[model samples]
Target: MISVVIPTLGTREKELIRLFQSLSSQTLQDFEAIVVSQDNHDKVKELLAPYSFPIQHIKLDQKGLSLSRNVGIKYIKGNIVTFSDDDCWYKSDAFEKVQSYFDQHSTGIACFQIYDPEKAVYYKEYLKDPREKVGFLELFRKSSIEIFINLSVVDKEKVTFDEDFGLGAKYPSGEENIFLYTMHQEGYKASYVPEVVVYHAKPSLDTRLNNKAFASKGPMFKRIFNTPIGIALLTLLFLKKLNHLEKPIPFYLNSLGEMFRYKKSRKR
Candidate 1:
């Protein structure tokens, strides 16, 4: 069975409704939904009450995407685990495909693609063919919604997102990168399937630049690597993002400064 963990801030009622509508039509009924909310517990309960599928709701006073996910992990009732963004919905056969992949392959974690229904295209350019291993750099761009973990193959206890990063946390992004990189470092094999299983709207450029999204990547590189290669990777990244940013110098400097600060924090 597939266990889907969805973290929400009690906002996005319309989006969550659309998401549940998608899940309600899923061809695979073996999956369960776990909704972890920071607020509006009563609202979430009332909203999900109509859905016939088994659903679990956990209320929390604190907020942070990573922390909510970590808490949801403890309540998982299935061997396969996946995180779902409250605003995103899935294709009808998404769970079926995921379950089939885990059954046929030995990969501990599998990453798939997301499609933008309004745009009529994949969210981004993904691999054209199947990949046996997702590299460090590729994992940086991978979204959490695209990832699925088979607990029977991975060490379930060690699979967690860092609390310091992600949507509501201090740095406000890159927690997924740290999560996947740590999984790879722990000897778990990851594979990418060139298939679109989820649907989400394409984000605007303004949202992409919000909450120090680019600035946090530098510190994330540090968390992924212990050696000087982290610096080398940051230089490569600077070159890539520089071509599009209106102010590349500040972006680069912010990344570099944040990385150094993160490194210092690790020491004390």
Candidate 2:
């Protein structure tokens, strides 16, 4: 069975409904949806009841996405675990394809394409051969919606999301990238499949670099890579995405500053 874990803030009621509707429409029905709610728990439970497949609603008092995901992981019973965002919905054949791929390939991690309905494009600008082995740099391009993991592999390695990162934490992003990195470090093999599995109708703001979100990258860099590597990566990111940021100069300086500050705090 495939266990689909979704961590939500209960804010996207409309999108959440859409997501579940898609789940109900899936060609494969051997999956359960675990909705980890951080707010409006009761309402979320009520909202999820109408879905066709088996559903589980877990309430969380905390706000961090990583924390919510960790909570969902504890309750998962399926051998294969998948993650989906509250705002994203899967294609009808997604789960079927994922299950088929894992059955054929002996990989621990499997990634599919994440398409943006608004942009009318898949997230990966460059496509490799389908079912190609993906390592460090390639894995970074993935998001939660595009990936599935064999729980047995990750459980053996004791891998979980980093609570210090992700939405609603001090760091506002890079949790998925780091999680995949951790899995790789723990000796898991990840493969990329060029199939459209999920759709991301992202907000316009999601494309831009704001102060708080950009600043989080400094610490993210330090945590996932080394501090020196983090600084270099952050610098390159800032340079390449300068036009996407409102206050490019100030944001770059503050981001580097925050990285150092986060490092210092860890020592205390």
Q: For this target, which candidate reaches the highest lDDT against the unseen true structure?
A: 1
Q: What is the lDDT of residue 42 in candidate 1?
A: 88
TM accuracy, model 1: 0.93
Candidate 2 lDDT at 207 equals 59
lDDT of 1: 0.86
TM-score of each: 0.93, 0.93
Residue 73, model 1, lDDT? 88
Error of 1 at 22 (Å): 1.1
Q: What is the number of residue pairs that collide in model 2?
A: 0
Q: What is the lDDT, from 0 to 100, of the residue 204 in candidate 2?
A: 55
Candidate 2 residues 142-216, lDDT tens each? 788788897655563364788888889888888888888888887888888888888886555535467888888
Q: What lDDT does each candidate get? A: 0.86, 0.83
Model 1 spans > 4 angstroms off: 204-206, 263-268
